[model samples]
Target: MISTYRAVVLTRNGGLDALELRELPLEAPGPGQVRLRVRATGVGFTDIIMRRGYHPDAPKLPFTPGYEVVGDVEAIGPGVTGFTPGQRVAALTVHGGYAESIIRDAGEFIPVPEGLDDAEVTALILNYVTAYQMIHRVARLRAGQSALVTGAGGGVGTALLQLLRVAGVQAYGVDSPPKAGLVRELGATFIDSRERPFDEAVRKRLPEGVDVAFDGIGGDSIARCTRAVRRGGRLISYGFTSAVGRHGGGDNVGGLSGLLALFVGTRLLGRRPSVYGITQLYQKDPSLLREDLSQLFTLLAERRIQPLIAHRLPLLAGRAGQELLERGGIRGKIILLRDVPKKT
Candidate 1:
């Protein structure tokens, strides 16, 4: 068993400088928990949000930031079943995934299929699952319908496009100019968000508006995108990427209020466009997350969908990875490899 491992700890809320790489003693899994020798961890905007002390669910300082990991089970605690040491698995951890090894509730760990890339599996846990749930569970998107995905070049945005393709739904993606080709390759009609009047750009194409609109870039963007949803359509707000640099240290009350007003106003106009804000961490049922992850794994095993890996950096490069994500315009998921050989 490994005695000590390197981990990226958030010493305090700030920028990339807050992330500290330190060697720490590893702990054994308690009952109903299992320890994993992490192979790779996903680098996401949520991590940055937490680092900036914006995420409401973020833990106290000196915590790890990764939300998902793919690794082999290194040890199993008492009362844990359905898994054995050396089994490959992927688990969603609210934190602690930035470490080379982590202990998580056994229920949170899903056994990964053999022959799948670790980075791909890591991508599926958070980004793909969120997209799948939003489209299938929340929006209930149907075949032949149309939907608009804002921030459509990022991890979850691309996932939405891929899943929408399999469902036979027409997808319209809003992203920057440089990501236009990637959006097209993922089977979505690209609309450059940098262009003014984004809502008009979308409505001009659909005319009657789309069946649904998924907005992760919150703030006024949500109100504007709501205009692209047809009557009886749904608008799902998953993240507040636009509120990142705003004053007041990540409190998004004003932006959320604007979104609420839009929803109310649309209903008063008899449009009945439903608006929803999603935070997967607040989900009450663990089984539902497990089930969703299982279905996504099946899709991956069948080669029905593929996750785009934008960059793969060593675990120690956590600071640099976060910097890259903060710069924006990334095409897909950035992953941190945990077991990479260290420099001599």
Candidate 2:
């Protein structure tokens, strides 16, 4: 009999009920591809956005929904090199990661460093890469320059804090009180957005506005973040979790105002603010990935960055994990795990 495995594939989009666990036959890998025995997968808002047909560029209906996976190489196709059977690796999968086995391009895979837990590696890849690219590539802040990050205790925000500290930069984070301690512990000065207006709270500490402003909450908050950036400072716009369901459904989070300000600010300050619709590391520049991953691996090896795992669920329970992510109170990553095969 041919090999077979289970995967979490959505039968449809537009609603949460469409999420279904399905079975599919496993096959040998194509050239430059490897079959991964997926151990863990991270749950991000991108999954939910794609599920709801909100992500403009995502794949069409009835497909597996996961962007990253951690596993061991089960099989390697011809023309592939370096990776061998049972090698621990993490893949920035284009699709099919929420499964017991996945065949993915070798170029997208990275060696999972020894001694780090699977959950940590899974969380680190997506979040840290976005953080690194936005900070080092996009923001390009000078030493001692300060930044204000909204949602500062979330995955990308926390990772940015770690990277910022490494670059000798100071950060002010806006978050709820429950997450204040974690933000402070990450070496960020905290502003409570739930308790006070984001701009007002940020001004109390920053006074003349921060050197950079990193915003994930787009809508109206984008305007506030635009104003908070120093005249010659930068604003890295990355997410729109703020516009998902809560904000009257307008592109309120960093929409037109963000773009207009992004352009106008450049002329006024010489160094202008820019909003990144998506982190381009995966698309425009894949070569930069190896270096970025190596840096993150070094941080992991040195124990300079620690992962906070919010929850882990079975692949079949991916919908539940997405629901937990949508309900929106967690501070870390939710991972989907595959079961180890059982003896007959």
Candidate 3:
């Protein structure tokens, strides 16, 4: 019965002003598709990168910018079975999630188990999956080994810390002093990036370096991480957040080209350097995403890991949420909800 829905549209890459909330016509699901009433969507540094025209995977201008969403199937198109009206589901939207309703291929969404909070489930879709894949599939780190995690208090960073503990890998987390307690509480040895260079501080404690290191800060942070790993160990560079701050956090950062250059530099040093993008990997193997996400859901249900949710903002507040994320110091994922559930 809804005739229109709201979504955040990125008119062009620039500052927070580029993000605009617009009402769009509602369209029924086409064959093989489902129309969902969105419950929650996640916003992170990636959204900031896209807003500043620095994410390689971002779509053309005048597009939505949400990466993941949890919703209820309000309508199902013909040829779609398995999903019924009112069924709860989640999807790795990649874009088009900052909305009240959206239509996408039914295959794009996976059923979300009941009793899990919508915001928490939204957090798992992107951040947790990225962390899970990097540690297990990419690094193949084993128990008793050691690793270092940079940006240890952000969404993916916190997820990485908790998962590293579950894998029984000793972890060293680098962050500002303000976040030391949160990092340490997650069972990681905290290294203050302010005391000195992180790699030097890490070497002071671990003379031989760790078994592996994960760097999402990119830029010069990548080189430091390469040194933090043992001679034969590996370094996985996933994001380029540090670049955002260099030009006032609003100017375009060179996207993947810059990140790749850093990786090549590290590789030239005889250390293994790898880069990861959740959307790129999911596009290649959709089933892998399903399998991994299902495992993460189980872990959440069993309370093996708790996702840190720093802020939950209203749907239309997408711009404000991204601004807060840009300011940094947020300890976890920021979720945008169509409507906040009232406390009982």
Candidate 4:
């Protein structure tokens, strides 16, 4: 077994510069854990937020910053079952995934089908799970209902569109013009987000407004989504991308306050439109996470859904990947690949 491996470490909270490639010590999995030789790790906007010290779940500095990983099990801890070395798997690390090897609780690792690409399954762990939970668990989105997604060209946005399509939900996606084709290709009607008054744009497309509006861009965007949602419709806010770097940087106080006020206003005014915030980290049920991931994996194995992977970079290029994601205009997930060590 290797004693050391390379990982993308976040030395401090800052921009892309904060991400550094470092050699980290490798250790065997303890009881109930398994060690994986990571093949691919997913880069996400959440990683950017964590690196910027904006996410409440951000780990202490001098730690790795990947949220998801796909790999082959190199070792299994004592008392572990249902897995053996050489089995392929994927996991949601929440952190500590940007490395050549990771030791995770066996319960956290989900077996991935043999034929699927590592990068593809890695994308499903965090992005797809978040989208799945929001669409099915939180919103309970039903067939034939219409849904609107802001930042529809992004990782979660695209995942939402794919799942919405499978669920037979008519979908509208708001993004910049460059992403129009991608949005349409993903089975969503594309509305240019650059257009002012996003709600009006949405209304122009759907006269009755949408049944559900998914907003990751927080701030006034939440209010706009509220307006775009029909009475009795729901608006789910999962991120504060719009509020980032505003109000003294990284703090989403303004956006949270806006969402809170909107929720209260809707309740008091009997508007019938409701707003809900989601943070997957706080979910109390581990079974839900596992179930959602299993469903996604089954869908993937059946070729029912395809995850859009924007780019694949070497493990060392994590910073560049983050910079690209931050610059925007990417249509899908960015994956980082690490070379597997040859068996000794």
Candidate 5:
């Protein structure tokens, strides 16, 4: 008899209902692939877009939507080394992560650092690594600098805020009113985005201008990031949770118009400021994606960065996570399937 494992497969796209938890044959890792017994999976905004069939870069239909996973290696394919069976690990596979078992190249998996729980480490992988790479590698933030983060209390936003605070830089986080405390807890000043304009909100925190702006809101939110920065400051536009499948990419919602606006604004201005969509690390060095994962795992060992728990849901109830993230009530990461492993 074939062994079966549960997986949330996106055979097609539309709503959270598209994610069907069903049985699949559990197979051994192919060459250089590591087979993981998934312990926890993070529900990110990207997954939200992919589930909606929007994100232009999202995988073709009938593919899994999960971007990252935290789990233990149960098997390895030929030529795979540096990891053994039963070793705790986390990976940024970009797909196939929403399953009880997943296979990916060995280079993509990072061993979970000592003293960290699988749930916490899984929560930290993609969002924290993406934020860390942009802030440290791309922005090269300096001490005493100021920064603005849109969606400030979300996974990426919280990570950015925390990193800036640790570097001795002031951070302004734009989030909903209920998340205000969580944003402030990350050592950032919080602004309730629903009630105030982002520029005015951030200005109240930094009367001058901010030095760097990390924007994920991707609609007119880019304009807010624009207004917050001082002359010569850099703006990193990455996510478009609001514009997910729309704008510069294709049909959907918020679109990349926010990004286009930044580019246009740069051209209209005298050219002192630089506005570029992020994906910089991915463009420059894809290997850095894995390296960033490694670095965060190291930080986790030392408690330099911590995971914020918003809510935990079952892998089958991904819609709950999607709703929490979409509603914007949660400040930290939402982890799915706390105790259940997809594979036995």
Candidate 6:
């Protein structure tokens, strides 16, 4: 068996330089665990926050930063059943996925159907599932209802538009001028928040407001989203990009406290305030993630949804992939494919 593998470790909280590509020792899978030969992992803004040492959920420095990965089973520990070597699987690792191999609890992974692209599958594990659960489970939006999606053209934002279109929901997507075309292409009415504030743009188009609004760009963006929501409509705050600064250099505590204050203030206005964190929800019930992800896999199989991949970089380019995501202007997800060798 292989003894060591390459991984991108966050040596210290800082800029892109903090991520170091190094060879790390590998260990045998412990009981109830499986070692995965990672095929692809996703690079997201959450990883950016974690890298900057601002994310409250981040582990100590000098750890991996990947949140989700798709891989083939390399080995299985004793007491783990129903999994054989070479089986492709996906997991919500939340860390340790920016490596060539990872040993995780068997229960953390679900069997991935054959024929699906590994990079696309990695996108679904976090982006699509979050979109799916927020729309169906949290917002519980039904067909024909109108909703607003902020940060449209982002990983989760694009996922929301695609899934909303599939569900027959009318979507108004708020984004920058660059992403307007992509958002509209996904069957959403595009609102360029950069041209005008998203709340004003949404309200101008939807005088009565929308049935629901999904805002991932937190901070004052939360309150802006609530304004676009109808009296009885709900606003779901899923992320805090602004709070943490898209490229870092933001205050974590201030951002979170401000988020809570907005929730309370929005509630006082008689608007239903809600929040959705895929990790937190998954922790409450792992089966929900399994079920939702299974459905997403089927959706991909049927070609009902497509994960827009902005860039496919080699595993060692994890830091570069994240830099692209942070710089923005990309329409969709950035994937780190382990099978692709980094250019020398």
By lDDT, the best candidate is 6
User: What TM-score does each of the candidates earn?
Assistant: 0.92, 0.91, 0.95, 0.92, 0.89, 0.96
Clashes of 6: 0
* The 10-residue segment with the lowest total lDDT in model 4: 269-278
Q: What C-alpha lDDT values do all the predictions have? A: 0.83, 0.78, 0.88, 0.82, 0.75, 0.89
**Candidate number achieving the greatest TM-score relative to the actual structure:** 6
Candidate 4 vs candidate 5: the lDDT winner is: 4
Off by over 4 Å in 6: 252-261, 341-344
Alpha-carbon runs more than 4 Å astray in model 5: 204-207, 245-256, 270-284, 338-344
Steric overlap count per candidate: 0, 5, 0, 0, 6, 0
lDDT of 4 by residue, 174-261 (tens): 9999999999999999888787788899888887789888888877777778788887777787877876742236545776766674
Q: How many backbone clashes does candidate 1 have?
A: 0
List the pairs of residues colliding in candidate 4. none
Of 3 and 6, the candidate ahead on lDDT is 6
Pick by lDDT: 2 or 3, better one: 3
Task: Please give, for residues 80-143, the per-residue lDDT of candidate 5 as tens digits.
Answer: 8899788988776667777788888787777776677766777777778778877887788889
Assess candidate 3 and give its lDDT.
0.88
Evaluated at residue 155, the lDDT of candidate 5 is 82
TM-score ranking from best candidate downward: 6, 3, 1, 4, 2, 5
- How many clashing residue pairs are found in candidate 3? 0
lDDT of 4 at 265: 51
lDDT of 2 by residue, 170-267 (tens): 99888888999989998999888878788777777777888888888766666677667767777777877656653123354446665555566444
lDDT against true structure, model 1? 0.83
Residue-level error in angstroms, candidate 6, position 181: 0.9
Better of 2 and 4 by TM-score: 4
